[model samples]
Target chain A: MNPIRQDFPAFDGLARPLHFLDNAATSQICRPALEALVRFETDDRSNVKRGVYARAERASVAFDDARKAAMEFLNAPSPEEIVFTSGATLGLNTAAHILQERLQPGDVILVSLLEHHSNLVPWQLAAERRGASLRAIPVTDGGRLDLERLDELADRVRIVAVTHASNVTGAITDVARLRSFCDATGALLVLDGAQRAAHGPLDVQELGCDLYAFSGHKCFGPTGIGVLWGRYDLLDAAPPFLGGGEMIRRVSLERSTFAPPPHRYEAGTPPIGGAIALGAALEWSMAQDWDRLGAQERELAGRMLDGLASLPGCRIYGDTGTQQRIGVVSFELEDVHAHDVCQLLDSDHGVMLRGGHHCAQPLMERFDTVATVRASLAPYNDGADVDALLNGLEAVRRKLA
Target chain B: MNDALYDQAIIAEARSRTGAGRLDAPTVTAECDNPLCGDRITVDLAVQDGAISDLAHKTRGCLLTQASASLLARYAKGGDVAAAGELRAAIDAFLKGQEDERFAILTPVRNAKSRWDCVTLPFQALADALADLEKRG
Candidate 1:
């Protein structure tokens, strides 16, 4: 376990010593998960829960094992509660549609301003379909969710969908507290763990949310496979999201009966290969020494914050030095456009970072910035990455000055 | 990944640029923005007797894009309108990583085709402005 740069294969061949600071968008694939993907496609190529042959049976068993692995990853009560969709957006959309269909007109749906479009848009569409009211809990200048506002909206709020950590600001929202409030108000709580699940432990039981959604790709797994964990009773009560072969128990001209919890939510052909790879990714992440990784990333972020603070006209956004914050830090320099900075960093220094609104327009609107350059970190990133960024910023400053 | 790309000389040249090509008569100018990256470029040209006599640009983008904008400013200067169109064509070819037998005209832009748009933002902006000028004329 080389704590500095194990798990990822990209760090090996990088001559310029790639400083990947775009983990908020996507993670560099881990070797174990990549190997699992290759092995599954090359050696064990078969569709799960179909065909009666030995290969098919083996594939079925592998898929079932992956489900159980995902269950354990989220601390789900049962493997049956996990439903695999295309990704977090799809999972969130599925929950929104299903829940909205159940709601009558004038029902209230509450969401926070810090949500990613994946978390926000679904509820908007759902509210539109049901003619429901959509309320957003505001954020302070510091970017934390205003917990006091939640009490006002909780009484009428039917489904409270929020992100555990904001993608843009890296601000962590206390979903556990939200869940308690929602429980008292008799409102269903849905957590978007897409940004937080990769960095730390996630337990549905501990978090106590009625439903949770997360994507696999952000956690070093293959794309096109996302998890939707729901309470068994809630899932049992909801209507089927998609209809087809796997999700159907019986079909007739009169009426069709759907399968149990997980199966009912998962319709059509699932991302069998992706699910298996995700299971492998989860296993790899679980084996890591998180205390070391967390400390290293925080130290790196601290250095970045300090470096940016010393520069003239450099403004750091969001909660910089907050313990609950993720590895991402967004900032802007006066008279120096973020794209210009990112281009200089990438083409000249090979210091890859993201520069934009980071798909959280509401957060950007909150911060009053058109865009910010974000340098997000992963476990494999070291202090050198932060140093390279500082050097690149100096060059950018000199060029713009 | 070359230090030469970020060399102080290049940065200084980019920062302290005055103008491009021969001085001439009425010519069009244009600007563009990449909303995703927030890169911006403004191009100015002087066209006389249907030939480009002078070209200049002010830009805020990555080094690659600014470098390309500088090259475009040089190439667009002292060229006929037809030649400017030809330069655009050559640029399209260069962007696709295609070789134009007219290599000398494209020497300043060679090996930069991978990020051609970043470099040629000014050229495209000017081309569009010239098209509008022709429509008005």
Candidate 2:
């Protein structure tokens, strides 16, 4: 396997090099994907699906090819099943608006506490609009989704949107179990794959999700582009989210006929450069050896966790084992503000990490803390990064003492 | 980690409790907080002859916030209640660039001018608490 650090170019310019542990917020762009973005704008710039000229036709083909490649990347049933939106927020808002319209008043929408606010707020708006009952599937004490309670609540649920991995706690959920539960209840299952898509293998058919949404930027592609993979039948049945030029087949003063499936959801000029870059990113990701990447991160996380545990008053949250979690690890120090810890890491050790509620406010309330300092890893992160964070914390503790 | 932000003297002040301006002694102490950035301060003062006789503060957050509270505590001890209110305006004007020389004495609190809410958080709590104290007496 190629050295994972070689995949990213940003690290080459650093002096004494800083360790970046904020991948959950956004991953550093890979060199190949950045090149793809530049090539698209410089060499192949044209409006897609419209112009009959050679350049326009070529652009259209590139756009369609990227869509098809994304379909293959997600193992989606068809190219038409994917709808490109601005990002996961827009995709989820579209899903929520459509689902809310379909569900009658008094129907139930069951979400989980583990969901990001993007996933939770949209559904809450929908539930409030339709007078639907909203329920939260409890999380286990260890931070896993409580499947036992889910079985009991299944009958009342109309839609179940869950995070495949927790952003704060780094707890991985059992998607197959969730799928089975949703299937038995005849409820639609939507997976928030924003955190899982690049890190883990995903097959929509295998996961049994009716719809899945993930952002391109979080997976080393450019921002402002994301993909929503829905079963073709569901896409056909759901109402279009926005109306504009590209989404209609015919228009008249009186009435307009809408286009089919993916185009029906894509209303205006799409993010052509972003989609092309994302396709390149997916290509790079697929070529990687998962075993090496996962093992390296797991080993790095274990070393960090062990070092943190050895500290006098360090307290960690969620699952510690790599088998049950992702690369993101969160912890708090006794009598020290998380912000202080993050500042010290950056100033003293050149380690960049996130310290705040992480937009997981409910999780913070559940854990009974105002905030936590999180260190998330990418494939490029090595043992040195882990050492830097631990040593920085030790220095902080000594100075504070 | 920068000495300019958290100097040794500031750390020493934070660690010490004497004349820390803790309001626990006041019969009508007031505490205020800026929940967004976690800056907090409690004001302790004794009012006699319809004038401010004593004032002090216990503060935390950035240096500017602490320094602003320290400045307020010093001036408020002998000023009348109206004078204390007037000082808020002077500080607000100084923060807004109405008086440039006034800023020199308030340099430690200048960084928070852009982040006005943080710098004035302690003063806000003290003002409200003082109003409450006057109401009760």
For TM-score, the strongest prediction is 2
Best by lDDT: 1
Looking at candidate 2 chain A, the ten consecutive residues that score lowest on lDDT are: A1-10
* TM-score for each candidate, following the candidate numbering: 0.81, 0.85
What's model 2's TM-score? 0.85
How displaced is residue A356 in candidate 2, in Å?
0.7
For B5-112, candidate 2 gives per-residue lDDT tens digits of 344554444455323556445645788876654456778777778687777777755444565576667567678888776665676777776764533445444443
As for candidate 2, its clashing pairs are none
Candidate 1 CA-lDDT value: 0.78
The positional error of residue B20 in candidate 2, measured at the CA in angstroms, is 8.9
**Model 1 Cα lDDT, one tens digit per residue, B9-117:** 4455455453533234446767787655556777767777888777777676765566566667666678787778766667677656686543333334345444456
- At residue A326, what lDDT does model 1 achieve? 85
List the global CA lDDT of all models: 0.78, 0.78
